[model samples]
Target: MTTTGPRVEEGYAPVTGGVRMYWRSVGEGGPPLVVVHGGFGVVEMFGDVLERLAAGRRVVAVELQGHGHTADVDRPFTWEAFADDVAALVGSLGPGPADLLGYSLGGGVVLRTAIRSPEAVRRLVVVSAPCRRDGWFPDVRAGQESVSSAGLEWMRRTPLYEAYAAVAPDVDAFPALMDKTGALISGDYDWTDEVRALTLPVLLAYADADGIPPAHAAEFFALLGGGLRDAGWDGSGRPASRLAVLPGRTHYDVFAAPELAPVVDAFLTAGG
Candidate 1:
């Protein structure tokens, strides 16, 4: 059972906030699968994992504004705006029922997109997606300040970090970068009741050793179920939502984990 690995195709779309997104597509073009990169991620950061999962279908890895090689936008960071940008990109690509997958910040965008247009998404996979549960952060404002002051060198030393490093000399700016990202993350984004209405297939993957604990992942799954049950959907013992913990993985490896490939392959195959 050999697979035709992922390939790359350039993609660009303009959105509000004057942001122009740059994305790369891989695989052989079945039902479109869009891969939204994390806040601090670039297109090629998830190359290994995306390529493997994209073996049999089209996989689009996106680079949001101010990340990777994408042009920086003048507006402040907001997941709603980012999600809208994704909506525009996905809308421009082709048609309905596309697979929406997001990692970290990207996952937040995917969740919002699924809620925004459930009809457009066939399957949703959110890897280490952050949520705004009660006490989701510790003095988020102060946390931003701390991360900004410490910079990427400090992040490199901690197991809590999950974003990509700068490819140039501006690595010193990571603290501010992370601070801005954190501010946006801690803002108004909340998956509490929004994602529960989605009836499409949903896969939630979190690392056993991730910064956001597996308990949080389970809680997210439970909350999702509660929401769906309230909406009179299939929120019973056999529902469309699932939560899995990747053994021996951390925040950064949640998406890059080698084990992810086969699991995703099986899931997509079975779903199809």
Candidate 2:
């Protein structure tokens, strides 16, 4: 990962409907890329990848409600609510749509944002997030079902906890965030039909060993008009969509991989 880059600019965007979303901006020139980090993730979670991407384009990494510097609101933690928060943040940034990239929980949030307010998103990238509840591997699904706020004590030793402690506005609210996230993940959901109708170009990037099954990734690609027919010599039959399975990585490490930035850059710059 490249270590050299411009200084990062950090600030909070007052999102409509009662939330002050925190964001970090880096780099200059090119189109703006709004990054949404996964659950329990802060801007630092993206680390080098965020820095690298910022080298060529502006990278706005946002902290969703209850995550990172953003404090939790009274509203229930639902994907739809988070999506709305992101859309409002993007709008507050400026006019015109911005490219969006999200990982895991953030991935689901970005997808929902695209569906709910397509005009706010110019390009979409979803990394290691499943569109439906059952898309996860059996073990992952089972684990999500059993997770609870009590796990907060067990997670205290983890890097995520440490990171949160360093920057979270109220470290004492960790347990509450965990409970809300647990409820959100454990809930049932399926957005296959909505995804199929998305007109914007989409990229589904994941680790080969992601929590989601490899077959399910292919199923998602098919839903986006990929894997169903040959592209022909001119490649006209292919949809404006892509799938990338990074090697030797898992859901935990895919977003931080050195190879991710370039793939995402190429796809987003490819244009519609």
Candidate 3:
């Protein structure tokens, strides 16, 4: 399948929390949609999705610290820290809340940002990210635990590394990014309570065969008032939350699925 990325207007969002966050924007008119990429990922990873989403509205793609064009800092990498950076970036953009869409590691950061600065997010879309560490499959959890900087040599041959080499501000810092990301993923965490209390609308999209267990995804939807009682003819029983399990997709390719952008646009555009 051939996919083309949107033309972007890129710039740095001045140093905040000791690291300068890099961002790029595409499209015109309509509400802004902040797109956050996954772990060990750059803005290019969402190239196709951004291209599709940008067709109807502004899409702002951001690269977190130690990834892509953003440089590393002394502070430890944590969801809270990433959330703060996103919030700061939104604040710098000017007034009004922007919609947020995140995939994998970026999904967790977006969730935390919604929780940390509720006023900054108009809507939230989390793709393939679990609210708790244990939500992932056992093998996936084990793999995360064993990840370390020692795999740098192996990673050198990966497309992720190649992509980084092409655009990262400091290609030499790839190992550091991997180490910090590993540490973040290895840590145990749970945000069920916060998620359950969220007031803004949320759309939880995941691949049917995601790294996270399907059971966990259902559980998360339950937290959002989904899978409860059946909706009446008028559909009053259903919560504002939405969920979609894309068929024939995996954790790695869900973000690139041709069906995703349209579904997301429908959800975001539908009135509550």
Worst 10 residues of 3 by lDDT: 6-15
RMSD of 1: 4.8
lDDT per residue (tens digit) for residues 47-119 in model 1: 5888787778988888776676565655667777777787877877887778888887788888888887677
Q: TM-score per candidate, in order?
A: 0.80, 0.96, 0.95
Name the better of 1 and 3 by lDDT.
3
List the global CA lDDT of all models: 0.70, 0.91, 0.90
> Runs in model 2 with CA error above 4 Å?
1-4
lDDT of 2 by residue, 118-151 (tens): 9999999999998899999889988887666789
Better-scoring candidate (TM-score), 1 or 3: 3
TM for candidate 3 is 0.95
The residue ranges of model 1 lying beyond 4 angstroms of the native Cα positions read 1-6, 133-145, 149-179, 226-237
Model 3, 1-272: lDDT tens digits are: 99865567989996467888899999865578999999888888975788888888889999999998898999889999999999998887778999999999999999999999999999999999999999999999999987778999999999989988999877888888888999999999999999989999899999999999789999999998888889989988878889999999999999889899998998889893
- Model 2 residue 67 lDDT? 91
**Candidate numbers sorted by lDDT from highest down:** 2, 3, 1
Please state the error at residue 246 of candidate 3 in Å.
0.2
Model 3 clash pairs are: none
lDDT for residue 270 in candidate 1, whole number 0-100: 61
